[model samples]
Target: MIDDAENKEALTSFLQKLVNDSYEAELRRYSSLLATSSRLLTCDSIILVALSSIASLIVDGRVSISREAFIACVCVAALIGASILFSIICQWRIGYKDLASPGEQVKFVEKSWEKLSSDWNIAKSYSKTLDIMYKSVSSRNNKISVLLRISVALLGAALAILLILSLCMINRACAGA
Candidate 1:
């Protein structure tokens, strides 16, 4: 009976640690995704600025941008804007939802530790907590991952369009000369 009790205790400890570590890892991954999204937005902004500058030069007659090139630029600009918007929405959707305040979490953990000495009730409670945390984080991660990928693809398409537009503008300038 004593050996069985010891084994159960060890198992509970291991399980708790495993779940907590996994939760932390998920949080880290989420943070990294946010960083990536931020970088994407920054790049999008730079592209917009360049497009605006070119449009201004065309308006001022300093550059002869073809109608096709202008249309392509507009399309690419729209895509970039859409990508940024979708990315922000995705980040907002996966934003952190606090299950418990820090103080409450600490108190609850302390109580669970106290219960550990008396019975397996604390282990059971921890199991439930871990389940909830794991599922929530995993769901958010999956959703954000899909959205991020789409956003990236949109950005890539925009860049390609911008490249084509630049080529068209160059050809127009050469022909005009």
Candidate 2:
């Protein structure tokens, strides 16, 4: 037979723990999205460097290639660079999601404290917080997803263009042009 005040206090403590854990878990889920973006950025950088290095070698007279091949190399480098730029933008956006900000954290704590310490329900507060955070993450991730898609598409297009142009150059080489 617990008194009513003690029961209320115990419920508040339990709810506080549950809400905090839920919030932390939500933040943890975002880590996976960031990791995926990071891996994509790495791929973009590696391919850009490898392609540009080969292009530079040929373009600088270390190896002779036709003007068409030269053009292809230049185009490939530019396109890959563009892809990298977009990826960088995606990373920048990821860098500043609302939950990452100190001010937002403060606001969240204040709201949680107010709700959990008063007549307000912790579960309701957590529900609303989750919904708001989800919308924020979803909208930002949507844009980042779009940017990643564009980056991938551009890289593919650049590779295709280079392949087509390189094949033409190879034909010319075989014909002793």
Q: Could you give candidate 1's per-residue lDDT for residues 1-177 as a string of tens digits?
A: 335888877877877788788888888888888888888888888988988888899889997755777788789989988888878876684544447778998888787676656445665676677678777877898888888888889999998987776677678779989
In model 2, what lDDT does residue 57 have?
A: 83
Model 2 poorest ten-residue lDDT run = 93-102
Predictions in order: lDDT: 0.79, 0.72
C-alpha lDDT of residue 108 in model 1: 81
Candidate 1 Cα lDDT to native? 0.79
Q: Which regions of candidate 1 deviate over 4 angstroms? A: 1-3, 93-97, 100-119, 168-177
Q: TM-score of each candidate? A: 0.79, 0.65
Candidate 2 clash pair list: none
